[model samples]
Target: MDHTAYIAILSVAFLVLLQHLLGLANRNGKNKSRMRRPPTPPGAIPFLGHLHLIKKPFHATLSRLAERHGPVFFLRLGSRDAVVVTSAALARECFTEHDVAFANRALLPSQRLVTFDGAALGTASYGPHWRDLRRIAVVQLLSARRVGCMSGAVCAEVRAMVRRLHRATTTAGGAVTVELKRRLFELSLSVLMEAIARTKAERPESDADTDMSVEAQEFKQVIDEVFPYVSSVLWDYLPVLRWFDVFGVRNKILAAVSKRDAFLRRLIDAERQRLDDGDHSEKKSMISVLLTLQKLEPEVYTDTMIAAFCSVRDSFVAQAEIDAAVGHSRLINADDLPRLGYLRCIVAETLRLYPAAPLLLPHESSTDCNVGGYDVPRGTALLVNVYAIHRDPAMWEDPGRFLPERFEGGGRAEGLFMAPFGMGRRKCPGEALALQAVGVALGSLIQCFHWGRVGGVEVDMGEGSGLTMPKAVPLEALCSPRAVMQDVLQKL
Candidate 1:
């Protein structure tokens, strides 16, 4: 009797657990009969759901799924429901008509910790707080006029990068094996440092040298630790794993965030002192601009809130374009960038093939919305598959090739559908500044150096797994200063 009773209790408990799981997986259970969800592919487990289907180089996995299931499909990612939109038309619909409904960011576990609990603009929900942050970002920090005013700083950094490469080649007495990824990261970080605090970064002593200032080093380390885990952690999708603090992601992210906040606070204090002393040349730095705003509205832009607002590959059809447009008479300047149309085309095509972030930071729907004629229920996470859309056979001819001419003349995209920086309200506000910096740097490098494969073979273009699509292998090339530009290099 005791054994029979125990077996009956076990069966009852299993039934209850199964029923709860069914409800958890299909939270729309009450309205399931009334609603129309996009088709979910088969082979989902009880607890894992479609998470079992997810694989690394994540956007590629989603693209393949789009091929098997239609362009728009629903996914049960652990407890959350996600709608992955892969077509250009569907991407348009999500960002256009249904944009507001899908404007909020998913409250991912990583974002919750790293972003100061949605205080940062990138992770903030769509509301008054986000509106104010956007206003400040546009009007004060990233305005085109402001970015142009900072072009002098950008030009100076580009010169430094050229000179650094030139010095390395001279030290080697011939073509030096150059790792472009590390050099480029330092360059970009240097530029960012200059913008943030007007700090002049010491160039890396070698390819293996660490990033800039003590603060900058901490910043770089934090980014390295936090970026890959931000939206992709398994704990973010699974409550049980999160409960166990799987991989120590929560502690790791919080520690990084705390370090960043502390360093930024010190910078803010220093800047505040400089302002009191009437040092205005630093006025162009992003920190200076925000501090100035804080004076007028200290309540709105608290030092804590002030903390929030803070924070690509090269090619050559590029070389020919730079030579024709700017000539070897001098190094390329920010102004010369706009005229190097072919160089811009090269950059555009590269982005089309390998977007920095293949899948956009997930956007959460604030209300029920229609996407590709299917209902996306409120609170569902929206993932726009930019990779798949960019490579669509029907939309692009020979989508696999590195054809830069496709963007030449009339071939310029009708819209930013080739949105490398993303689109809609949350599109990167610093896009203009980024392009300006990239244009000058690429044009200068091509005009200054003769780059060749280290082993007389094609450069490998394998992709690495990250929020930013890094090259699988660091690019090592034999680089020699161009004889044609030696006079210019000597002057610098």
Candidate 2:
């Protein structure tokens, strides 16, 4: 009785174990078969995966890989899987058809550090919070109406910059050699500050103006330093390294964030005080607008979100457009922006050649999707190579040449192929404001000054290493007031 019972129990246990193993094997095989992963480049190594293939100026490296592996290819960087879309067709698919699936941001370590752990509009994941931030950004801060109201501020800043450059020319005793990139950055920052907070950026006679408040100067420096490292930090792809803080990048980022937050707090405090004092004389700053909304929806519009809102050189068919539309009677104003269609084209063209964010803020897929007919798994980091898409020879006739006419009368249509500020639901909301600021500033410069390359040398135009593609060599050029506009310039 004991032998028969033991044998029966053993047989039943063995059958159950065999069935379980067979079911496990079938499930594993089915899962593998269902997932049609995108084509990944060869030479993926253990642990490191394909991270070694990624190099500085990552957009170019990804573009080169796309040339070999195809426009839409998978990459495994450390423990993360990424899909790089380098062609317009694939990019279109990602933004259009698969837009919702890939609407969320890939919150990298560095981005989290700079953005108050994804609290900022640009860094926040796609969700109700993001929607609220975006709504405030679009409807309140960056609407065409709001941007138009702030045009006075933009014009005032541009005029001030022109005056500064004019003073430089007089001081130099002729056409002066000016490093334009720093000036451009200063101009951009000033316009943004004035528009957002109704406060002027006090320039202390030099770029290294010691007279500037420590907080102000430190804030500016943090901005300059943090932007380039936002996406390029080692810990972005290799999260494990963050614990070690091997290069002290985390510490540097923390310090920068602290300074940034402090500076923003000061601005917010000042705005609140002014509001409390009932000084409604000035046009309300963007900060004030957000604060009003914050009172209604405190949960959505936090100080960090308001602070986040507080965040180029270009071409000459542009000049002719400006001349034709604006003439020499008065400096170009935001009112003239609509008529200066060709000038807008030039801006669009410049962005195409050199997008502000070369590898646009990375996006993450919320669900499995198909891009360019390739399977994109959920949680895959999506990098759209705007630099490559903009310059893809397949999409453009003479993609390398600088031709604003390519955008003539069809610039908006061409936006599908170009994404300097990104595309789809998650695209940068500041695009309108940026264009307004840059268009007026660039146009005024061209209208008031005759620009030439210094020493008869070509402008370097080589791209630098940064999230924003700065010039490796800051643009230095010779400048003098246009003879016809001297009267207008002198009045300023």
Candidate 3:
């Protein structure tokens, strides 16, 4: 019995030794690959090397880092080795030629729970699941052709927006200080709700259909509560305090999720009933498409999956255009869309200056590879500083200025210099739709009204905290109907 036991123990130990040997061999191979390549210069620091220095409003901070460290440099972001690609040339290396190895995403805590385990395209890792979801979203939901079909929806919504804005203009209160943020945010919400729910808020008619103010209040409360939870926080990076959540953050998120889910479920149930009753005209939305798909191919689509898809698509679509409305103005329209090409420039320029995700969502190195002549180990997290690349003084004439003309007449888009939509396989698929949405909306606002700062209030260009870089003040202005449209405005 003792002899047999000894043999079994010896065999187990032998197998463990073999595994360690192979692991060491792999590590050695990876190290050799790095030695043969150009490594980025390490910033000066001890255990938390380069971590404390690179902080947020990251574009400005990284610009300074680039001045000190050059185009490519290595730094420690928490325990991770982040290879910062600042210049357009380095950006190209990460996105173009060496794209495949760096296509996977960094797993953050908030994104995991909020996005239903990263099934949505924006936060999902680059793979089959992401590709499939993106294909579904672009082809079925956000394609140019599909978005064009939404013009009727947009016109109807804008008419309501005009009605509301005109009401504000004529309110006898004398030059109302319009919060463009409130108007634009509502415009965006209405469009998104109709696109996904296929119904607008019904005007109060009789007692039975009387709108519940309490329900409306609850829904608004839920949305306002959830706005701040999308950001990447210190706990998101640390992971140790995730359960604790630091500031009752987890409870707030849980409450918001519960409220949001309840509202969405009610909408889904209503849509289902509408479909059953042959009343498809009023309730044909993106949710309906997903539901229809789920029913027809039960094996492929689940209800939870449909819910996640709807939630994320709504979030991205809703926030996509407002990113462009930083300037003090109101609703943009078709008449103004063509004339305000410079506004498109501002949107593109803003994306360059303050890209939605400055770090561009972390990507993992799938294989040991060489980048900027440095050996990158497999599983290395890649943080491509799109902000740094866009503002690299070498790429543009006056990189710091808010100029839109730079994109015109053969501007600096040669390499990866102006990759606001990202590059290669991971480029944002909703880019065309986002462009049209921003262009048309901004253009219309500029065309329909004469906009000025409220009470001669200075337009604050300060930035705020979020995954998306939104303007701090959220745009405030005084707007009046144009001279030509005054008669039309009066009739309304």
Candidate 4:
């Protein structure tokens, strides 16, 4: 070949190689650029932003994130935006300082249909109507006086539960695998119902006694399958879904809601009939109080309004279902109240560990503000993870241990940091009733039985999803009569 021809061929070959190398460099450069972007927090894998974190239990994922990202961090799950708060200081800010600003609940799709246009106090927006309804709820249903008056019911139910436990133990060869969660739920339910029903005698154990394993399992299944899905309905945020109602998800919820609403209507109707017939007295129930308000102030509050306000429909009654299925012991009646300190501690601990509203009602910033040094603009959705805060090591001495003594006297639970009921103006009005019910129940349980785990492994204190963090495994315990050693309990 001629020298010029050789040089031309060589030049063409060089150009081709150079182009290939440059293309490779650009591709590699793009890959490196992507890698350089801070790996989206811990627990996230390629192409999925924090999806793996949610697959595991919620508490574990949150605990892991808290460890890596300090107390607070931003997260996204399938296009949903969230900020997790894990410290008491931040929780305090969300609960108190930011109370009014964050009072409005982030509208949940499931409750929107069921809550009578968001009229229920728990899900309602912060407004004049909300304030008025809350006022009535606190004064009428959840007031200290109302809860205190229900002490007799608490005593009655606890005694009944003890009697049932005694019967089960005697019947089952002295060792019964009694479901503590359901029993406790029923106890709480009985008191709440009796308080609402104003019933004097102990409520009858249902034909399908909630204590039985089959009924307990069914109750749990209904809650577990139905609740979480309903709460996170895809349509709430996505407007496009509204036109077609999106994927038939709304229909399923509506069906479930209809069934639930029917159950509540029956309960309410029965209560109303008693009032109409003059069978109810000054010892009126919370429902009756609501009915009275509706009658007296027909303009502001009507029967439907009262029903929406205080009715133990699926939204509220499901809590009782969950409480029963989860196996906390029943609420103690008045006679056993003195000795059931541990039950109170358990309720406190449960609230701490598995906050009913872990993130709490999402608060919208009314105006631009700086919280924890980050600029939070108005219209931002604020979430405070009470679960993370309760278990914070800095705030708590031994956060994970189910130690109730920390709250015993002038201790960690007695001050600013301890608020399971939330704080400030938008605080939960049901605080008084929950405390009274939980305390009396716990006291009675301790007084009546010697509670210990059934499987012998430490009670699996693992938590599950819900409005409340319930025991992953309902508490199954062997209840032995405490009356034999009543003298010792009396001393305490």
RMSD of each: 4.5, 6.0, 7.3, 12.7
Q: Sort every candidate by TM-score, greatest first.
A: 1, 2, 3, 4
Give the clash count for each candidate: 0, 0, 9, 16
Q: Between candidates 3 and 4, name the one with more favorable lDDT.
A: 3
**Model 2 global lDDT (CA atoms, 0 to 1):** 0.81
lDDT of 4 by residue, 1-492 (tens): 899999999999999999999999899678546432211376644444465466435555776777877766765553344556667777677656666776777666667877776888877788998888888887777777777676766666656666677667656756678887778776665665567555443323543354323322333444454576545654554445668863777777777666655555655777788778886466677777777766778787665566676511221232333333332444334434344443455567667766666656665566555556554544556666666777777778788776655666646536726656766666778776677666655554554556666767666777666556676778777776554434433332
lDDT for model 3, please. Answer: 0.65
Which window of ten consecutive residues has the lowest lDDT sum in model 2? 207-216
Q: Name the best candidate (by lDDT).
A: 1
lDDT of each: 0.82, 0.81, 0.65, 0.62
Error of 2 at 213 (Å): 8.9
lDDT (10s digit) by residue, model 1, range 8-104: 9999999999999998868757676577788889998887899988888888888888888899999999988899999988888888998899889
lDDT (Cα, tens digit) per residue for candidate 3, span 1-492? 699999999999999999999999899878666464433445546555566775666656766777776776666665566666777787788877789988877666665766777776767777788787777787877776667766666656665666566667777444556787767766666666667766655643322211223334345667787767765456665556677765988777777777777777787787778778876553357777777777788766666666666612322222343335322234445334444445656667667776767667667788777777777777777767777777777767787776666665445544427776778777877676566655666555544556677777677878775656678778887777655455545554
Candidate 2, which segments miss by more than 4 Å at Cα? 1-30, 201-218, 311-317, 411-416
- In TM-score terms, candidate 4 sits at 0.75
The best-first sequence of candidates by lDDT reads 1, 2, 3, 4
Model 1 lDDT, residue 482, Cα: 87
Lowest summed lDDT across 10 adjacent residues in model 3 is found at 311-320
Estimated TM-score for each candidate: 0.90, 0.88, 0.78, 0.75
* Model 2 per-residue lDDT at 448: 86
